[model samples]
Target: MKVTLERTDLLKSLTHVHRVVERRNTIPILSNVLLRCDGGQLALKATDLDLEISEQIPAHVEQPGATTVPAHMIYDIVRKLPEGAQVSLETSGDNATLELRAGRSRFALQMLPEADFPDITAGEFSHAFTLTGRDLRLIIDSTQFAISTEETRYYLNGIYMHTVTTDAGERFRGVATDGHRLARAEVPAPAGASGMPGIIVPRKTVGEMQKLLEDPDAEAQVEISEAKIRITTGNVVLTSKLIDGTFPDYGRVIPQNNDKTMLVDRDDFKAAVDRVSTISSERGRAVKLAISEGRMVLTVINPDSGSATEELAVDYESDPLEIGFNSRYLLEITGQLRGDTASFSFADAGAPTLIQDQGAEDTLYVLMPMRV
Candidate 1:
């Protein structure tokens, strides 16, 4: 293909598709991006067989053709070139090589036949909806950190997205859990999403899709079928196969009726945990929280290393309760709170603790306590 595109435009599109291209691939074509030029636009696509991303950019087309070239190499070449430089791309004579030229720099990259590149078809979707960029980002940012990396429980490696009708009515919900901690967040459901089937969106696709929603003005058109899901907006499309396994029934794990409530400054609690955790044991990273009438004390006792304790005033009036939890889990949960105050509900040291933003009921976290 022979096309001329501004460096900025090409770079913007490349940045989105490159996330799907793996650094190493068992199939050579998996490491390359498919470039097609036609109808006054250029499309770039990349896939690792599980997830695929494609973006179209405006270009001056001299010839209508298509080819595959190394994804990372082309991205680097264009990224390093001077800003506003015009990039000219063309296939070399008979050799199936692609040449990239910008100002005084030029590079020739090995290319493969476009026919060898895999294209994932837009599958049948039973449900489709539109969401603003801000709302879409809130769904991902709030729950993505809880996804599991464990390979055996493949179903837990993604965020569970579905529609739920609460006492307030139908709402779109996202939940993620790694057995130790769980994050659940929801937003008002769009018009046609009632009774939509729940699907587990794989971790990689969640990450790549999150990046695409960074534009404040962008709106996403989401389509879901039995086997795959597609999200498209502003010339970029991401398609991925949903995890086939069923996610664990997360409701059973969420604490039901914990009554004791304690509200503390989020920054203060995070700082105390961070300081005390420094003396915690290497393997457990455990920190103990002792809550009394109106005072909360954080203590870390590592018999082999050292001990630390910090006290903070809190808004607890119930009987004293002591709980131990992994410091990392505490930090992650606290970091996600959007307001200045964080509330925690406790049953006892052994029971699962429930956390929430002081007055917000839509988002909640459940963290299992650790034996100290």
Candidate 2:
């Protein structure tokens, strides 16, 4: 294949596709990206067996051909080229290497036959819908932090996406949990999303889609089936295999009868927690919250180091309670609240605590307490 394209255009497209290729591959072909030049555009594709991304960029095609080359190598080369330089890619006559040239610099990359690349997106999708980038990003941001990293319970490693009929209307809900905490966020269900099967989208797929949705005004076309999902936005397309295990019914963990309610300034609470946790042991990293009628005191104690305490005035009228929590988890959940006031409802020192933005009910978090 022979093609000439602007360095900026090529670099942008490469940045998206190269991320799908794994750094180490058991299969030889998985480390390479497939490049095809034809019809005045250059198409680049990369895959790691489970997930794949492909992008098309305008180019001056000198000859219609295809080949595979190291994805990271080519991306690094194009990224370092001088701004506004034109890049030329041509295959050698011996058919063993791809020659890349820009200005005074040149490099040759070994090639694998394009036919050896595996195609993971060959099946039909049963459902398709369009979502604005804004709504999609909100759904991901609200829950991605709670996804579990443990491999033993593989089902909790992704966000559970499904439709529900609420009192207001049909809603699409994204739920994620790590046994220690749970996050649920919802948006009004888009058209053509009704009757879609509940699917567990892997964490890696969720992250990749988040990166591609940088344009908030753009629309993403999402297609899905029992086993896979495909999303297309502008010049980019991503397809990923769904996690096979069944997600646990996360609703059971969310406490509904927590009667104690505490309203505190979100920013003040976050700062107090962060300050007190400085003296906490790295392994434990636990902070205790002692809440009374109208006052809350945060405390952290380390066996080897000293102790720290901070107090904040809150709006709590319920019975006094003391609870312990992981400082890192507390900060992450608080950061997700968009409003100035953070609403915390607690059942007791040993039960789960429910947190939310004061007047917004669309997103909720449940955090399991730690022993002080």
Candidate 3:
């Protein structure tokens, strides 16, 4: 293949596709990116067997052909090229290597036969839908952090995605839980999503989707089946094998009647928790929250480190309650809240606590309390 493309265009596409190539690959071809130039467009693809990403960028194609080269190596070479310089890639008549040229720099990389690249996007999809990048991001960002890392309970490792009918209307929802905490967020369901089978998007795919769908206004096409998912954003297409497992009935874990409500300035509460948790031990990272009529005191006591405390005024009229939670989890949840006010609903210190942005009912978080 002989193609010349702007450094910026090639570098951007490489950044997205190369990330799918893992550094350590049991199969040599898996570490290389497949490059195909034809019809005035240059396409780049990379995969780690389980996940694959492909992107196309405009290029001046003197010849139309395809070859595979190290994904990271080509990405780095193009990334370091002088800004606005043209990058040319060509394979010799023998097709054993690919030559990359950018201004005064040049490198020859070994090429693998394009026939060796695997194709995983073949099967039929049960459903297909479209969502704006904004909605797509909101679904993952709100819950991704809570995805469980425990490999044994494999079902909890990815964002659980499905459609639900609420009293108000049908909504598309994403839920993730690591046993200790759970996050659920939803957007109004789009066309072609009703009755679609719930799918557990693997952790890596969810993260890649988040990164690929960076433009708020861009539209993303989603196609899914019980075994895989494909997301197309702009010129980029990402496909991944789904985790074949059943997600637990998370609804049972969501608190139903936590009536005691507390309103606190989100910034104030976050700042207080950050200050008090400074002295918290790494192993036990627990921060105690003592909530009373209109005051909340945050405290952390570590045997190895000194205790720290911070107080903030809140809007709670219920009886006093003290609860402990992982300080890191608290900060992460608070940072995701979009409103100035964070509403907390408590049912004593032993039960799961529900938190949400005061006026935004589309998202909610549940945190299990720890004994202080």
lDDT of each: 0.92, 0.95, 0.94
Is candidate 2 or 3 superior in lDDT?
A: 2
Residue pairs clashing in model 3 are: none
Compare candidates 1 and 2 on lDDT and give the better one: 2
| lDDT tens digits, residue span 1-372, model 1 | 799999999999999998789898899999999999999999999999999999899999999899999999999998999998999999956887898999999899999999999878656889999988877788899999999999999999999999998998889999999999999999899876776789999999999988899885788998888778899989999999999989888999888889899999999999999999999877879998999999999999998988999999999999998899999999999999998999999988999999999999778999999987
Off by over 4 Å in 2: none
Error of 2 at 328 (Å): 0.8
Clashing pairs in 1: none
User: Which residue ranges in model 1 land beyond 4 Å of their true spot?
Assistant: none
Cα RMSD, each candidate:
1.0, 0.8, 0.9
lDDT of 3 by residue, 1-372 (tens): 789989999999999999999999999999999999999999989998889999999999999999999999988888888898989998888748899998899899999999999988899999999999999999999999999999999999999999999996999999999999999999999999999999999999999999998899999999989899999999999999999999999999899999899999999899888888889988999999999999988989999978998888999998999999999999999989999999999998999999999988899999999999
TM-score of each model, in listed order = 0.98, 0.99, 0.99
| lDDT for each residue of candidate 2 in 20-52, tens digit (9 for 90 to 100) | 889999898999999999999999999999999
RMSD of 3: 0.9
Clashes of 2: 0
